[model samples]
Target: MHALPDIVGYLAAIIGTICWIPQTIKAWTTKETKDLSIWANILVLLTITLWFIYGILIGSIPLILGNLISICAVGAIVIAIFRFRSQ
Candidate 1:
């Protein structure tokens, strides 16, 4: 049904957005990203980038916001990982 897709999208966006909070909090508090894999993060970032673009193309606020937040969270982790790794 058409309604099912909307419901699923909303739920997915909420869960995906909230799921990122822990990683963001941990990175902010610990300022350590040594445990995160560069390749993994890169892949995730790229995926998010594509999702964000898709969201914009379709004018989906949930997708846009969710992926935008994910980008920030993943980007922070990547920065921390590199910073801590160097030190």
Candidate 2:
């Protein structure tokens, strides 16, 4: 069965999703994304969006949930990038 693979995917997803938290927290606390590139963020968002779509198409729970959470986490960072720009 594919259960093992799916479980692995979920574990991987959890790790990937957690990877963004530190950056997000730093951005939120410092209110700085001055060094971050908008293009890079956009590209990352686009890639994640595609993954989310793919997950939907395949009906993989791990892919779906992981990417959804990732979208929100990374999305927050992107929003913060725009929201906390230095004047």
Candidate 3:
């Protein structure tokens, strides 16, 4: 039988995932990446990437799913920074 998502785990995932929204919105609004640090984004993206791998390894859906969403959001910010900065 498939185990349901733990309530606390679900809440944790939601909180972490939602926390990324403000950064995303800020990037979207400004369309300027100069205010953000490339090193910080790279570090965060790397950390999230590892967390995602760990989540998968542990077979924790909440962890895996949450990190995946975070990667996308943060990834977009990283890409936007590089893309806009390049021009």
Each candidate: RMSD: 2.1, 2.6, 4.2
Estimate TM-scores for all models. 0.80, 0.81, 0.80
Candidate 2 is scored at a TM of 0.81
Q: Which pairs clash (backbone N, Cα, C closer than 3 Å) in model 3?
A: none
lDDT score, residue 77, model 2? 88
RMSD of 3: 4.2
Q: For residues 1-87, could you state the per-residue lDDT of candidate 2 as single tens digits?
A: 899999998688779867877888898888989997878877887888899999999897777787888788789889998998763
In angstroms, the error of model 3 at 55 is 0.8
Q: Write candidate 1's Cα lDDT for 1-87 as tens digits.
A: 699999998788788876866886897788877777889988988999899999999999978988999998888877777777765
Q: Give the per-residue lDDT digits (tens) of candidate 3, residues 1-87.
A: 334667676677689887877888888778888878999999999999999999999998877888999999999899888877855
The lDDT of model 2 is 0.84
Rank all candidate structures by their lDDT, best first, as comma-separated numbers: 3, 2, 1
Inter-residue clash pairs, candidate 1: none
Better of 2 and 3 by lDDT: 3
